[model samples]
Target: MSTPASRPVTAPATALSGPGSPRPYQSYVYAYPHKTAYRPLEDRPALRALWAREPKDALSLYLHIPFCEVRCGFCNLFTRIGAPDELTGRYLDALDRQAVAVREALGDGTPVRFAAAAFGGGTPTFLTAAELERLCDIAEKRMGADLTAVPLSVETSPATATADRLAVLAERGTTRVSIGVQSFVDAEARAAVRPQRRADVEAALGRIREAGIPVLNIDLIYGIDGQTERTWLSSLDAALGWEPEELYLYPLYVRPLTGLGRLGAAGDAAWDEQRLRLYRAGRDHLLARGYEQVSMRMFRRRGAPPSASDDHACQTDGMIGLGCGARSYTSALHYSFDYAVDMGQIRRIIDDFTTTEDFSRAEVGRRVDEDEARRRHLLQSLLQAEGMDVAGYRERFGVVPAGHFSAELERFAARGWLDTAAAPGRLRLSPEGLAHSDALGPELFSPAVRAAMASYELK
Candidate 1:
């Protein structure tokens, strides 16, 4: 998900240690151009034709549930506040229709194998146990993806991670479950516009563990109002107490249209320094506690079951997204239903999606030009702890990453953000560079994409 409005100001590298280091972009560039760059398709294309030549042997499947119990203040994701009356049933009904249409579009000649699957959104667990079972049925019976055979992950919230819902997930072969416990401290949670008691969070975590999901992932946020180093560590220690399989530490981004955005929290030198300090402290603490860094925000407990293949490398494979907030990627284009952050706009889109009869054409998306594709290939791979594989890039694009992104690579190296010497053939970020991933990601964006994303109108 991309924030529809606001991009942070770029700061100099020298500002890292002091009051003026560049504001952390923390952009979470999971996908290139992001959903915000998608525009309505004037001539929607057939899904069959769109994905005809795309590789399908090992694909990733993502299902989005755009309803949450409460909207977090810093959240700019495309999800509505709550599902009222029969909304959940209606949404699932629409999802079933979408699954049927997408499956038909896959064509019968070649089998599309889903290697991994994930359910994410406002809160997937907000649905009833029966509703979740229906969700798994849509994935298994309708789409023909074997949930039991592949690694499946689902996202839940502290308030919604109920035992009944978790049992349904576990029975449906969910290998991992991620819960967002933004803060253990009630005050900090309130500051983030998320209300929850530590007791509830603990209970939810206990329930998830009891559900027997092999991997449990916890998400934490740093840099919220009234959050101090001591308080941050307390939250960290509390999260670590459960010995989660994975942990994601996110920096608070006050983007436009969110509650915090309305509060007018602008990025500044002091704020940047504080966040960086907290981030490093958290990073070092995790490193010393027998966890391995997967990326700037993700840490994995040693020997924990691998959550899933990081095949979000959508540049090379195909993906089928089955909800309003979900984005599907093909070799040439990325598409989804219209995206909006405002609750009214989100509800409108969801309603429209549920009622739609035509699901055969691509509706809203941006064309992935060759230049953009290379940039994506590099961005998705380079941001990982393992870094981009030089051989793999050459095999896929017929050119070395350095040959195409030499100028950008040189600049990053000069600023000590990337280390070509340590990794040899691969391009990897140095520790200092990884801390500024937000800055590094945008700096690599193609000028055309940057402008296109910038000009998109937000609700």
Candidate 2:
């Protein structure tokens, strides 16, 4: 859920990092125009006007729950560590009000249909079973997303994945439930400041399996301070024992203001090499066990039930994000509430969101012109192992990816990163290319985005 390193700075395309650059593990571009690129709008655009001309069919709906029981060491997502019951209740109430306003904004002029939904954050399962039911209600009755009909995914942590909460999710047709285990070795978990034991993690997995959710996704992190190839494999094997349908292997990134950062532990050349080694080990082990690589961090067991999320690729579809920590995306713009990682600032923003009566207009955002739109499309697609289709790019933009990104593509080819085999019809990363995706993603960032992200105050 957090970016690699969670750093405020970005790599400028002119100085693109390559194999010799100590391996740029400093960024992860899951979505284009990171929230850091956003600025307070001079004139808040009405949501109604924003969606009027955009395609609404196959929209992706996201809800953010910005509360966690505890914060891990390498964390900088837009969530508070702990929130009181009254605060959570207030947050849900605010969510209901916002959902109504957003749904109304997506009028009948365009057919507004959501193909997939996700609840992410500190942890959606942090809410009580009853509260979870209410969350689903807001999505269904207020936002008009048929959660049951659409593929819905929710994120959880080991401590909060209780049977009751899993039951609520299952009943609501949550097709996938991802649990953040971080590590199976108890000492490693503590080293990462995740504060969970192997036994507890096992119990949580058992509960999720019992809940009968179609897809169980286990998330693990490599590159913790003391993590080794042996310990990393131990964690990977432990998670695989559950035969989870999906696995997300993250490289731990300690950024400023996070627990690890405060402790003065930093990523160096050796650490970068260690993470790269462990990543390759984990990737190979999973591939050997019959899992297919979906991206740098994601792997799916072959023939596993597909997430409804697959119906809407985040790169192209319009998305409705309904929380202070979430972001709404359109072809022309990307917007969200103010973002901050400091505890004091996060609570302040959450408080502001809870009391917000006017959800009709966007407060902060970045306008995406044709140049940015094209960059977003290629960056999102080429990072994948499947790569971008030449026809698809041409059909949408009236130009080929090569026509616009010749220099960048040639540089990648020089590094043996781009696969010549796929060139005429498609653009895919070679195995080595996929390994360095974190570096490659930022190389595509527009100069303007780099400047904005560089200036944003992480705190």
Candidate 3:
């Protein structure tokens, strides 16, 4: 197996333009310090040893299907173009092997109860109906994660969200189906290097409705090359037409190694302002239409069922990831197969993952120290609209977040980004702060983690 040479990921002093400025869209703090921060374990820890003391209750199961019909330009996710004919079958077989190994590692008598589950990747729907059924069986039978008892979400693309696949997902008790409709305008879609027509996207939406899934989430992108306020509103209106249970308005970020990155697309002050404007506009539009703001990117209809339960948070709750791209999380460490954006590197890693006979040890990961865990808990909690529970933080870490992150909190409060007055027991973000979440998230990363992630092998 080959990996890229290491290089520190520290940004130049000049890159940080002070806390007052709207920093460039550098990162989205989605799943706690990203997989880039993870490195090969010098001594691969046995699964049984690593998870021996971790909580079995409130676990989340994530299945990664790293295959897509077409690669989106702006996307830097660890997924490859469509799998060849027999490759899908082999991949599922490998997944089954991994699941069996993981379940066994949980200990024969331990009862691991999963509170939530998700199928994400290049696209979960890329698999055939039969293949999807097998995927469900692996989750339910091999891993023993009850699908019907918990909330299950699956991601899909228009081309792959076929009727047959939807049928299998619906029958298997999928509560939420998030479809990537990036944009309703054909021009914007083409500009993003994700080719799809309005008619085709509409058809896919219709099919998803026909599948009888309870919740529908439509994802749209803002700040494309030629996207304007009018076009953005049009896309917003189109999404609202379905009265989707949830809507995610993502700001376009041209990251390194992505198709847009190769072209060196818009990454300037003007573009940032445009994206911010569009985001606010979209947020307000959704709110006016009876959608509640979950975060800067997510808005849900008031009456819609939640995407995940109130009790389960991926950062706090343990997760078992089941594919090459998936990252399994324990309280102390996050582990997964090597991460790569290049197609050749991804294929190599996937090939290794599929051929591996031993699935009892972790190959790549970073140890999450106590401080880092606190930072992660604060980040995961504060980023959401509901905010962090001060008493809960104290209960877990024996200190309040405000005192722990005093300097950062002071800066955010001084800048009017933190709403401390609203809830004495919670630490939440102000509207302005949520709007600049990308910039704020990176600021909270510990220096060591920043350097490690910066030094990660991109290819």
Candidate number achieving the greatest lDDT relative to the actual structure? 2
- Show pairs that collide, candidate 1: 15-21, 25-438, 26-438
Q: Where does candidate 2 stray beyond 4 Å?
A: 1-22
Give the least accurate 10-residue stretch of model 1, judged by summed lDDT: 2-11
- Candidate 1, 173-241: lDDT as tens digits: 999998889899999999988888999999999999999999998989999988999999999999999
RMSD of each: 3.1, 2.2, 3.6
Instruction: Select the stronger candidate by lDDT from 2 and 3.
Output: 2
Model 3 alpha-carbon miss at residue 237, Å: 0.3
Off by over 4 Å in 1: 1-22, 310-314
| lDDT of candidate model 1 versus the reference | 0.82
Residues 1-459 of candidate 3 have per-residue lDDT tens digits of: 000001112221225445556464667777666777888999999999988988887888889888888888988788888787688888999999999999988885556888888898878888989999999999999988889888999998888889999999999989999898989999999999999999999999999999999999998999999999999999999999998999888888777788988997747777878988899898888889899998877888998877686667655889889998888888888899898888889888888888888899999998999999999999888888878888999998998986789999898887788875667887889988888787778888999887887676679
lDDT computed for candidate 3:
0.83
A best-first ranking of the candidates according to their TM-score comes to: 2, 3, 1
Q: Estimate, for each residue in 209-272, the C-alpha lDDT of model 2 and write its tens digit.
A: 9999999998899998788899999889999899999998988887778888899987677777
